[model samples]
Target: MSSALSTVIIIAALLAAAYSLVTALRDRAMGWDHLAALGVLEALLVAQMAVGFVKLAGDGKGPDDTATFVGYLIGVVIIPVVSAGWGLLERTRWGPGVIVVACLAVAVMVVRLGQLWEGAVV
Candidate 1:
């Protein structure tokens, strides 16, 4: 995985989290803006996943903990989608709160993903 891409993903996730936090603070339900931010995040995650898969396909290209890294990649991609669905189901401020949690999770996971890619054990 490219560190630059990982950094971008992390920043985007944090921004999304902040946005969701603001929406939740305002006592508003998740709306189109939140969904759009999530959509962008999902797209970035998908791109990251694609790059990870391509790297893994090459001979001995990924980290020693390949299985775990792969798991993280898949999880990062799925989290936003699942959270978005859950958020949409609730018509309350908690909906955006859910997104906030998801975005923060994604940010942390991306950082972990970078460490995994570098074979850092933690």
Candidate 2:
């Protein structure tokens, strides 16, 4: 729910997404650096999940639609893993493309999460 944390997540996701897109456009193979970035992003997301749960439990100021919030949180946590797995399976530029898409999705979700934390609804 902290704006600072949400901003960090959004910036990180945008940076990663841009990097992945550039790599994909260049037709480069998947590399350890990209994977490492994804790993870091995943860690940040996990931390966010923890903070979010604590805040939600204490204040209950989050989205009114509990199911949607939970779904978004779950999706946010799983994206990096799913993208990394799919990337590893292909060994092509498309692998990086998958990562790019995932990162973009994460960024958007972070924004939505912020809105939800502010008691916004669909």
Candidate 3:
């Protein structure tokens, strides 16, 4: 995986997470902007998936454990999507709270992804 791409995903996820956190603190419901940010984040994740897959297929550098790395890649994509669906159904402060939690999860996964890419553990 590209360090630059990984950095971009990390920063974007954290920014979106912060936004969701603030909205949740304010007791606001999820809105269009919140969904939009998540959309962008999801796009970045998809891009990362493409890049990761290409790298792996082309015999590019990857984790010592490929399965775990790919599992994380799949997870980051699912987190926001699942949370957003549940958030919409919630229609309360908890909606934004769902986003916040999902974003935070994504952030953690991104960090782990970086660690896997760099051959670091824990």
The most accurate candidate by lDDT is 1
Model 3 scores a TM of 0.93
Model 2: per-residue lDDT, tens digit, 1-122? 77888788888888988999999999987789889999989999998988888887888466677677777887899999999999888788999999999999999998998777666765
The TM-score values for the models, in the order shown, are 0.97, 0.93, 0.93
Point out where model 2 deviates above 4 Å.
none
Q: What is the C-alpha lDDT of each candidate?
A: 0.93, 0.87, 0.87
Which is the winner by TM-score between candidate 1 and candidate 3?
1
TM-score winner: 1
| Model 2: pairs clashing at backbone N, Cα or C within 3 Å | none
- Per-residue accuracy of model 1 over 3-119 as CA lDDT, tens digit each: 889988999999999999999999999999889999999999999999999999985867998899999999999999999999999899999999999999999999999899988
- The number of residue pairs in model 1 that clash at the backbone is 0
Q: In candidate 3, what residue range of length 10 has the lowest lDDT sum? A: 53-62
Pairing residues by index, what is the TM-score of model 2?
0.93
In model 3, how large is the Cα lDDT of residue 53?
Answer: 83
